[model samples]
Target: MPDTAYNLTVGDFNCTVFSDGCLIDPDETFGLNCILIEAEGRKILIDNGFGENSTGTAGLLLDNMKTVGRKPEDIDTIIFDHGHIDHVCGTFKKDGSPVFPNARYIITREEWDYIKSPPGDNETQNGFYRHARQYLLPLHDRFDVVASDCEILSGITLVPAHGHTPGNVMVDLSSQGERLLCIGDIIHSPREFADPACLAAFDVTPAGAIKTRAKILADAARDGTFVFATHFTFPGLGYIRQINGVFSWAPI
Candidate 1:
């Protein structure tokens, strides 16, 4: 059975992380190890796991939500770190309707565009990109597309960390003097912290991704911020610290 949902209090607000489901893709597909986050109450699901593989495996999100006393309708915001399949595939039901009827969705404008006009001849090589456009395009009318850095709610700020995708972003939450940074796929593996220059083969622009990852790590380390990586191993929460001018991630 999956572990019970966990919560981290950020001042007066509570940020709970849940598992939507588990997937076992090729190591090359991930390039680095990762897990997804399913947060509840003031609910913000960071990403939706793959639904294409098997209904039981991909749709585990609803079950996990129920386990925590949350229903699909209870979700307020569905934040897409980027429109990758593992991250956004669960947004719709089997009937192809919005899963979170009442929640407003958000994604970087750049990412939205890239998937809309993906590079040709690269179609098969970019399965997730293709899936994102096909599935998410219909829901475009429901999105609150953001182009610049700004606050999404009282304790959450969207930090544009482009490169992985044109408008890939990270979420920052600050409350009661405590802060947490939800970095979406910035570093696929925690090990990347030991070598920030290491790039995932899937990165749209590997070099740009490296720079962005390093910058976010540096900032998080300096502030002693709690870090949430969408694709890190289970319980993807951690803290980044700088040692010898290099950043390292320590799970919290």
Candidate 2:
């Protein structure tokens, strides 16, 4: 049983992390990490994971939420940093019903457009969206596409971070002087921290990804902001620190 959860407190806000417990050990693959943000009686979900159909080892969102005293319907708001299957598939079920039926879904307009109608025809370019098509397309109307940097609530804001995906964004959070960034796929592996210019194999725009990855890495290092990565490993929580002349991942 890969049911695991971690509690991170930022000031008075609570971010409960749940992992689907599926790790791929080939060339440094990634597992999924989902988060629930609770504050002022509002329950917001970051991303849902690949649902119950991912690699037979995933789909632990619902159960793990239960372990942490949260129910599916308790999710008042659902936000996505991107639309990759591993991150968005759990938003809707095979029957075309939202897992968090009562929660509002948020995505970047650019990401949704790419998922709905990818710009190019390269199989690799759109394959990830294709994998998530069946489940995500049906729930299109449920999405509240964001196009600018705006606060999702009192403390959470969406910051645009293009490159890895057309409209990938970072969930910026601040509460009581503490700052945290849920950087989606900006640096999938800790090794990338040592080489911020490193690009992932699935990078939608190689050049842009390098720049975006490096910028976020530098900012996080300077600000000493705690980051919640969707991949990396279970809990997927860490901070960026500078050592020598390069950066490194200091997992907290």
Candidate 3:
């Protein structure tokens, strides 16, 4: 298994990228990059990768955390980028217990409602629905559901980027005027930067996904905001640049 953990500073916040290794599908390999942000004496986990329930080289986020001197219990807040299995499964243990027992959770109200709704027709998506229910439903009372773009903390904001999922969001972090957008599954490949219309098969609403991607890429390019992509290669940190209005990924 690939054990990867990288640490960097985001203005006043200490940010760490921990990998749950890679999720290998038939067509592509996705890096399960989860972020840990330490701000205001809070250990906030952006997403929980696949945990004990998944089979494969993935599910290493918890193990990787040890390298940075962090334990599951150390997490005070867990913000789910979405309800996807890869993003929420690590919240629970094989015995149906929460991995981060002491942490409170946050997710968009739309996403929470969708997760509890009836399963969809797509078999693959239904499977994801089941996993989401198993891992997240049990913690219903612990969740703080937000209805719109709002700041959950002093420097972190959950901006509605809904597309990939009903209430999927991108985390906007600002400290001392430096900004980083944790665009969860917004653009899987760097190639998408130049062609924002490109769609990911997992997107529930392809058109919305495309629109959100285009807007984010353009805005990031214009504002010179750094980005942390969830499915990009390990330690997915980069800046978006535009040439002739075509955005491109410039990895740092």
Candidate 4:
């Protein structure tokens, strides 16, 4: 039992990163550093952990949630940074009921479309496409399809960071002059920050993924914003900085 929940303050807002637990597939398959982030007191979850079949990697999310005094019922919003299985499967109970019953789920329209009819050539990695429908179909009534650049809350905006997935997006939070970007699987391992061109095998379009990584790193560096990577070890919160032409991640 590793403590997967962590809290940080950005001006008046409190952000907590909670784990749904971890997945330990080959580093080449799902990327070496995929984790989870939960923002504290906001009643929101960025990405849920993997499901039971993911081995011991599954179910720690509930534990981490409890550590932060957050129960499944307490979540007001469940934001899917992307529709990958490891990130979305934890949304359901063993009986198929939504784990976070009261929260409204938000996902990009592009992501929704991709999940609905993923290309056949990419079936293996995109298999989560089908699972997304299975797990989320029940919540269609509460699912809010958003655009690439939509604001989910007063201080939180969704920034389209396509390439890894057509609708892969990052959540940007601005509160009282402070900023943080919750980047979901953009740069899985911190080492990838040093070479943005290095992408995980799961990347739908390797080249495009690299480009998106570069763009995100540049923006975060320029704005001096904090970054919360969903899969960067436990408590995956850090700041991105650039030296010369290389990017560096400093965990906080």
Best by lDDT: 3
Residue-by-residue lDDT tens digits, candidate 1, 1-252: 346356667776666666655555555223111222233346666666654434454446666667767777877777787887777777876556777788778887788778778565654428757667777888888888876486777777788898776778888777778777888788877568776555465577678888888788888888788887776655678888898987676887
Model 2, span 1-252: residue lDDT tens = 233888888877888889876747566667679888888899888888888657777887888888767888888888888877778778767665777879888888888888877447666766667755667777677779888486898889999889998888989878999878999788877777666455365688878988998888888888888898888687888888877758887777
List per-prediction Cα lDDT, in the order shown.
0.69, 0.80, 0.86, 0.73
Mind sharing the TM-score for model 2? Answer: 0.92
RMSD of each: 3.5, 2.1, 2.0, 3.0
My TM-score estimates for the predictions, one after another, are 0.85, 0.92, 0.94, 0.88
Clashing residue pairs found in predicted model 2: none
Best by TM-score: 3
What count of clashes does model 2 give?
A: 0
lDDT of 3 by residue, 1-252 (tens): 224888888889999999988888776787889999999999999999989877887899988999778999999999998998888989888888888989999999899999988887877778776888866787789899886487989989999999888999999999997888999888887767665555466788878999888888888889888999998888889988989977777878
Winner by lDDT between candidate 4 and candidate 3: 3
Alpha-carbon lDDT of model 1: 0.69
Which runs in model 4 stand beyond 4 Å of their true positions? 27-42, 51-53, 194-197
**Model 3: residues with Cα > 4 Å off, grouped in runs:** 1-3, 194-199
Query: Between the candidate structures 1 and 2, which one is better when assessed by lDDT?
Result: 2
- Judged by whole-model lDDT over C-alpha atoms, candidate 4 comes out at 0.73
Ten contiguous residues with the weakest lDDT in model 4: 28-37
